[model samples]
Target: MRTFIFLCLLFEEFHVRFLVLTTMSTISLATEYRDVRASEILKQIENGEDVNLTDCRIIGELNLSEIEVETVPNPKYSELLESGFFDGEDLKRYGVNKDLKVVESNIKIRNSIFENDLDFSNALFNKSLFFVEGNFTSTVNFLCTTFGDFASFIGATFGDSSYFLNTTFKSISLYGIDFEEMWVRWDSLENSLVFDGLTYVKLVRNFRNLEQFEEADAAYYQYRKLRQAEKSWILFQKEWPWISFPKCGDIFMWLTCGYGVKPFRAFGFGGLIVLSFSFFYRGWPAISLRSEEKIDRICRLLPERLQRFIPTIDWPNPGISRLEPNKHTQKVSFWDAFYFSMVTFATIGYGDWYPKDKFRKWVMIEGFLGWLTLGLFLVTLTNVTIRP
Candidate 1:
């Protein structure tokens, strides 16, 4: 099934309903600025000059929308979009907004601050572009932006949300970019930013193209989680327990195995299951032992002082099991109970010990759980390891 990627939303920092919102620009503006106007920078770029500046405050909105139209056709293949940038799957929902502004200038504006919203929506840079350590006091939009050469945003901080909605790409680096919240929107009907389900699908495919399978899985996991939430709501609206099977199944898949991204969760849950059954066996006399138990016999082979700590019925004799039929049975150690629980869970009935009375019912349940968890573990292992 083709997931609707438009749901990835503009909440690249914001929109859920009509607009994706950024959380970084919540605080009251307090910084003072005395620097070049953003209009001048646009003029410089338009004049085909490389403008490099450091520690400068950019005043006025750096809106790249009204620039000379030089749009590149939306990338039709995954490989073409991997090296620089592309119209990501997020953009596919809105019927391809391809009126991209071409910025061929080599610009490096590092350690600077933007006093207004930085709207570089659909801007394509043909040269090296660096915005390292820059601070955006307001929303920073990078919707459908494409970098043809080196593009880096290392140590950048967004006071509000810096959006990458429908972000096209070739190659880019974003190390240590700080932001408070990321918001996504699913307003495909009227809003221009149509962040739907294919956004994540495209992203996951991109990661796989680069041979970053782990990242692809992680991205898929996030997308599926978000999709599950949406599905749960839709299911709730349509019907109750009768239609809740899908929702319940989704939750189970996520919790038991992280939708298969986290394989170790199965083993961890299995360990918990074993311990829980062990607690039941330890508190009550569930398992029975014969006169001279094999464990105690093995304990005798150890040093005298160590044998006391080995969960043996007696230090010297296996005859202790023969002495008492009632009171002696209750003196079960945690290890013995644990061993019995493990034996039952693993379906390895050695017959050295066996569950007694109603406790056999619990043994059956534990055995079932063992099968389920172990099966999940194997499935998850293959999911994380095999697929690209």
Candidate 2:
């Protein structure tokens, strides 16, 4: 019955998607852009032109991968250096002997759509680049690209995998981006990378506001892991023992409990500890109750009326009392050891089994460990359950 309901839900979802896709109207780009040829665009830039596609959509594949769009010189710099009165020799005689590198021209393509993969690998942009309301249907690559000025991808949609490996931007805006699956190597730029909480907070908020809790949790999880890694690395670099010890503890907590990302790991670790102590108890048989022979002093301390009322306390019969030590082997069996270990870890002092005087210190230590393990397990379980 549950399987039937799930199949119905899946079918309904697909039906809705099909209706939406078929009902949406198609957009044309030829009406807005005079020419869509790459050669024409390059030639125009070479002849001092500013190409702007502020709201155009491309219907076919737009191949701009590995293209050097930074070959265009800045208008201001060209006017100052390329005047007819200034010759190369005249400029060389002065201290201005540095090579004239090309300055990047502005390429604005806001509110656009690419029907195919958009590859911008190894591209250098000196001016601000805007992709507001832009949508790409296939993979988008910005690998090894350098942005000398600010870049914005606000309100953009990426339909497939997006790569930003080794990409550098002076300042970036990632507001309301429809992040499908972005591949990034943030550790390679750890020293220069700076991520403020605003963007990630907004991302999480946007997903949660849409009632996409699983997506929101995923984003938040990634955010937390990144934060932990960054902070842990910083702390691990400290040379002082006191300062570094806490960091080591933090790493250990992550490995054992996943910093509340995983609760089962903590449970498993605690279970292993309990089993190990069970073996210790099996070898030592640390627990035994006081015999009836030792109860004479207690009977003497009791009042006359109370002693008569509690006959068993006044003259305890070893055959009738369950609190007496077992008459079997001195060493406890595996099952008995496990039972006692569990009872001790729970701090339940059953009268039938009490720690022997010789092994009292070991029992105390085990009790302390049990307290810590149980406390950590509870806290981690609560965090994992309630936070997400």
Top model number, TM-score: 1
The runs of at least 3 residues in candidate 2 whose Cα sits more than 4 Å from the true structure, single-residue gaps closed, are: 1-50, 59-61, 64-103, 188-388
lDDT of 1: 0.66
lDDT tens digits, residue span 1-388, model 1: 1243444443432454333223334333434445989988888887778989887899999887645645665543344456556555644563245456788789999889899998876677889888998988999877656666767777777788666645654555555666543332222111222234665565466557656676677777877787788774244454543466777788877867888788888767777887787766666556676544675664356566754675544322121122244454435555656666777777776777766776678788999878776788788898778874
Question: lDDT per residue, candidate 2, 1-388, as tens digits?
Answer: 9999999999999999988776663333233533254455455445445667765655554444323333432232334367776655664453232222233666667777777677665456667777777887888877656678877787788888877755666777776777666665434333333345565665566556555555565566566666666664333435642345555666656655665556567667667766887667655546653444433343356467744552232222121121435554243334445555676676765554567777788778777767766677788678656754
CA lDDT, candidate 2, residue 374:
68
| Cand. 2 Cα-lDDT | 0.59
Could you tell me the TM-score of candidate 1? Answer: 0.45
Worst 10 residues of 2 by lDDT: 313-322
lDDT to native, each model: 0.66, 0.59
